[model samples]
Target: MRRRRLRALLGAALTAAIAVPLVAVAGDASAATNSFRGVNWADARDNYVNGWVIPSGLTAADSYSTVYTKANGIIAGFQSLLGANTVRLPINPQSVNDTWWASYKGAFDSALAHGMKVIVSYWEADTAKDGYVDDPAAWNTMWDRVTTDYAGNANVYFEPMNEPFGYSLSAWVSLCSTWLSRHANIPRGRVLISGTGYNDNVTGVGAASALSGTLLSLHFYGFWASDTTRAAWTTNLSNRLGSYSSRTVIDEAGSPMTTGLTYTGAANQDGNVFTSYFAATTDLTRARQMGIVYWPGLRTGDTYSITRQSGSGLAVNNASGVAQLRWGWGL
Candidate 1:
């Protein structure tokens, strides 16, 4: 459960470089660039791509290929249905080390082929014994190989791990710093450093000047709060995000999009947590001109998936998620 939330804020980043013309049009602050827009193309039991070894009763030798068709079909919806320019995909360290990445390469290529930037994120090898990304050795090895394969691709981005909240802040940053040193070829701008403590805040991360150039990844969810008022929710997100908006990405902000705009369920039965949080979050991102990625771009079991099965193709799920995201993107 904890692991899934961390990964729910999975890998995603496609920062659009801002090039404001010398002459700025009057009253155009909101027209400023929407840094990056994306979603987490999740992998669960049937579509788990972080498996170090192929699970039993599975058909493919590589992890991602097991769900290739579904992944490809979903990536197809990035442009028209979701109006997103980036996609975040979960990856296993062992798969990259053991050569599954060679076969699994197509899953990423499918997105890049469509001109969609791919943010390759590392989920824990075993969330049970090891926490989300516990083994430094395996992680180092995985990134070494993965970076070598994608060092030159401008469309590909790398995130060390989804959320390293378990480790001390210093230790987590140290690990990331080491990763930066080891993989110098992967541009710092292309790397994403997850904030501490379930990635709820990036203040500390933003202060780490040694880790400059890399983008910050933050996750906001209703479970973290009971306050549904727009002011409270907006303040919480803005305060936690601090001054990182210029280079930060809210890679995961999702609720029961399956239900309509009004949410009434276990997580939000007492309050309109879904609607308020989504609205405030969208407002904050839009105000700051940042970017966001919805959780579970198109995965089973997660209603936050803004994707659905179309006529032999994929489409955004019928819900307020699409509108909320589009609102933030100014689309």
Candidate 2:
């Protein structure tokens, strides 16, 4: 299913490009940061691709080894294509289980070894399980373990949850508050909470006043799946969050669809999508948005994977045209 979805999106992208030439105009290089600009390591249209595990046919050690190789390769490729400085690593607590500490420790070590900043996202049970009613005790316990183990590690950032889909505003506030309270022991200013799904705009940030010591995180993909409902949501979010001085970042963004429905060109309609997102960042430049992490950096046959159509493996392909845009935008 993942593979098929990627193929369809890639087809659409190719069809759109046929009618319009994809050009990446160079932006101001001065905007780059030590993480992205000065060091030329801005945020990336990062692939949520994991390499800590491989297929069943491989031995456990071999699996880790092979996955790490591919993972590092992908990171290098993205840095080259988007001039990105960081990669968001999704860590499933379930996968760690009884060996949670050991698994994550190893994963973090590997990420640091690759010279990439690690954004660790905690995985919770689905909404059907309990909505946002996560066991606060369990969550705190896990964080304690991580902080104690990785104290003073500059390359690590914690994402309390991913998307928080199906969760209400109050539920989100509660979870975020609990997570922030638990971070007293961890290094301050290294944790971030991912915004609500399909509506990462300001309205989605409900408890901005309550959250402390963590940067506000949100995702963007307005061009591909969002509609008027999402637009209104983002507008409300912008208005509500505009007054607050809290730092904000779009940890994730970019369109992975190949449907030819862009904001420019004949079929293009999502052109303003990226520019609008960038405009939102202008207000809080030092807020350190990091950069936009593009999904599916490889054009694999998945809805979110960035694998390409010509079997070009896991590297970013210019054939997508979006890659060029990312580079030009300094993402």
Q: After best superposition, candidate 2 residue 286: deviation in angstroms?
A: 12
Cα lDDT of model 2 by residue, 1-331, tens digit:
2322232233223322222211222222123232421111111211221222211112234444554554455555555654555666554334333343443344356547766676666544432222232555665666666666665778777777755654555456567777677666654467665554322533334234565445556544434333334244345335424432244445544443444323222133223554333233322333433444445444334333333422212344334344333442344
Model 2, position 244: C-alpha lDDT score: 25
Task: Name the 10 consecutive residues with the lowest summed lDDT in model 2.
Answer: 37-46
Which portions of model 2 miss their true places by more than 4 Å?
1-67, 99-107, 125-138, 165-167, 196-199, 202-207, 223-246, 257-290, 298-300, 307-313, 318-331
> Candidate 1: what lDDT?
0.67
Span of 10 residues, lowest total lDDT, candidate 1: 12-21
Candidate with best TM-score: 1
Q: What TM-score do all the candidates reach, one by one? A: 0.81, 0.61
lDDT for each residue of candidate 1 in 119-174, tens digit (9 for 90 to 100)? 88877645442334656677778887788878999988888887665655666677
